[model samples]
Target: MTQNQINQSAWAEKWPAPAKLNLMLRITGQRSDGYHLLQTVFQFIELCDWITFHPVDDGRVSLQKPIPGVPEADDLIIRAAKLLKAETGCEQGVRIEVEKNLPMGGGLGGGSSDAATTLVVLNALWGLQLSMEKLMELGLTLGADVPVFVYGYSSWAEGVGEKLERIDIPEQWFVVIKPNCHVDTKEVFLSKDLTRNSKSIRIADFIAGQHQNDCLGVVRERYQSVKDALVDLSEFSEARLTGTGACVFAQFDSEEAAVSAYRSLQKKWQVYLVKGVNESPLFSKLKSGNIS
Candidate 1:
């Protein structure tokens, strides 16, 4: 599509970056490089941060507005766009505008998803024609969680959360509560008390009702609000942590049940009623817009 055609397309104005949940997270081992070997299941949620990429003639990647408290240089969204340009040597530039709805530090994979969206959409918008495998490879350099979002599927992940095999998980309604505290992932992983020796389990085990998060004990011990939110949410359903979470979530078989729990929880907490999806919303839009 030409630049004028891109600007004329309805979907070009906004792209989605969806939040993800770790249906289960297990630290099976620690790598020599200090990165933990993870066995986790990742599923996308309906909640998303919308991003708009405005074409720029000047070959300069920039954000429309800097995210407060995050330096533009350090923002993952900026870094991802620059990475694409550096790898492809594409002269095309974009001004990124974000509608930041997902909360930071919630273990919801918000930043990683935003970065993945930048990589995927810009690769198309700039006519780079990089394959999905190449995009996933570039995404891994940004963060462990970014590749799955780039892959745009529900996955069974291992090896520091990058090795992915697409999985068909039942889409369920969820009630998520974001606690009034930030759970620093680095701090949680660095703690001497955090679990690092969980035995690896098969996808069969995950499907058969084993959704243990190794970080729960450590995070609960440190963040009282997270612990409290878990307790309150568990009152309605089996609440589980989504990856060293400041947000705890409970899945329901029906949307009605999820909405009921969300209503009760919202009175005292920052809550979201969301639906699990096998496909990332970013790719869904790409398909809808007939963008390959």
Candidate 2:
């Protein structure tokens, strides 16, 4: 079964928010608005976080479990819900349960995806009747990456990651390894040694295999765990950092090949073999009202 299928329940208490990889990232420049100008490809992976929403009568949002360092009230999911409700003037609240599968601060876009999933699911459950564009706008207010999850596709992204162009990425299996550490993204970006001046490159350039994550070098130098994982995964194939990460991945032609590597690394570190997907499974179930 797919990760989404594995994450859902017949008992009615779950939804799926898949993880993402930055196939290629180039920091073209830093915008005056404090956002970095970027060229990157966002690819959806099968590794995901599952969420369940329980509607509450009072206009208050809560989380089932606290995120590591964040309070329930400060959790992005709650913030997303509050923002949506206030914008729509809706008198609804929810208890959001997040089953965390994606590792924290791994540069895998986990929390942002979770927040987006909450927004989308709660919008539907509350009958908010907002267009996807409107939802994306609301999502951007939360975070740049949030809008891409709301759009629900693997894509080419730019401009602090808000601009998106839906693109088809090659279907492959990946052996992703997390070196049991959280690499702070903000630290990577704030480093004076980061390559913020990478030349601009087009989507066609990536299609031709001419782009790479500009943040990789800074991340590797600052985090030994990320460097170690990259080296380990690269022993099997060419491994690449996904965003500014403590996680690194190498693509395989088949699931067996990917899982074979995952098994070997499991004893030594955290590893997963997951398929890459172009479409979000949530779209399928919700679009058809297949909740039953």
Candidate 3:
């Protein structure tokens, strides 16, 4: 169903908003405008926040219920829906129902992914034939990370994460630990100690195991809980902080290894065992739904 053809039956289908991890991030340079240039590898995880749209007779966008501590209008998904409506002048409205499974402030790209999903799915459900490029352009206004999700692929991202080249890496098992704290992304970026300029290396370097996150040091120093989580996760494998994170993860060659680590950590921590993917789950769902 497209546009006016869409009915309440179309609204019954649920859509996925998958989370992403920055496999590696480097601060290549800082722009004169203070926008930090980046060299980052993005990979999606199985974790997702599911969303369902309900038809609203009135031409007003809304959420089923506002997330506590966040106003409905301030929610990224809400903002994304409104953005799409404004861009197309679509008179239709929706009450978005979110099943938020991804932890907030985990540096897992949950919000950006949610926003991207909203943009992509609504464009389809509303029968707005915006080009994927146009949608990605709109997504960038939401966040640097949003474009990657809208692109629906794992990629090597640069230029504050908007520039992307699709790159597929190993889809390994991951044991992720969400530290009992939120690392403020703005604080990490604004810190004087944060690395603003670092030599950028080729994807070959990352493939050959040059996985250094420039913000790791600053984040570790500022959040003791994050530091502790990294230290604990490291015991099982090579631990990495995804973006500026409160969630530290370790990749394992086998699900058994990841399961063992997850089991041990779950006794004392909030953690998840998930698999990595080169493509966003959203794309897979779209394909299966025959809606892409």
Backbone clashes in each candidate structure, one number apiece? 0, 0, 1
Candidate 2 segments exceeding 4 Å error:
1-13
| Residue 81 displacement in candidate 2 (angstroms) | 0.6
What's the lDDT for candidate 2?
A: 0.82
Please identify model 3 stretches exceeding 4 Å from their true place.
Answer: 1-9
Candidate 2 versus truth, CA RMSD in Å, comes to 4.2
Pairs in clash, predicted candidate 1: none
Clashes of 3: 1
Better of 1 and 2 by TM-score: 1
Worst 10 residues of 2 by lDDT: 2-11
Model 1 C-alpha lDDT per residue in residues 56-123, reported as the tens digit of each score: 88999899999888899899999999999899888887889999999999999999999999999888
RMSD of each: 1.5, 4.2, 1.6
Model 3: residue 282 alpha-carbon error in angstroms: 0.6
Please give each candidate's TM-score.
0.97, 0.92, 0.97
Q: Candidate 3's residue-wise lDDT over 65-89, tens digit each? A: 8899998878999999999999999
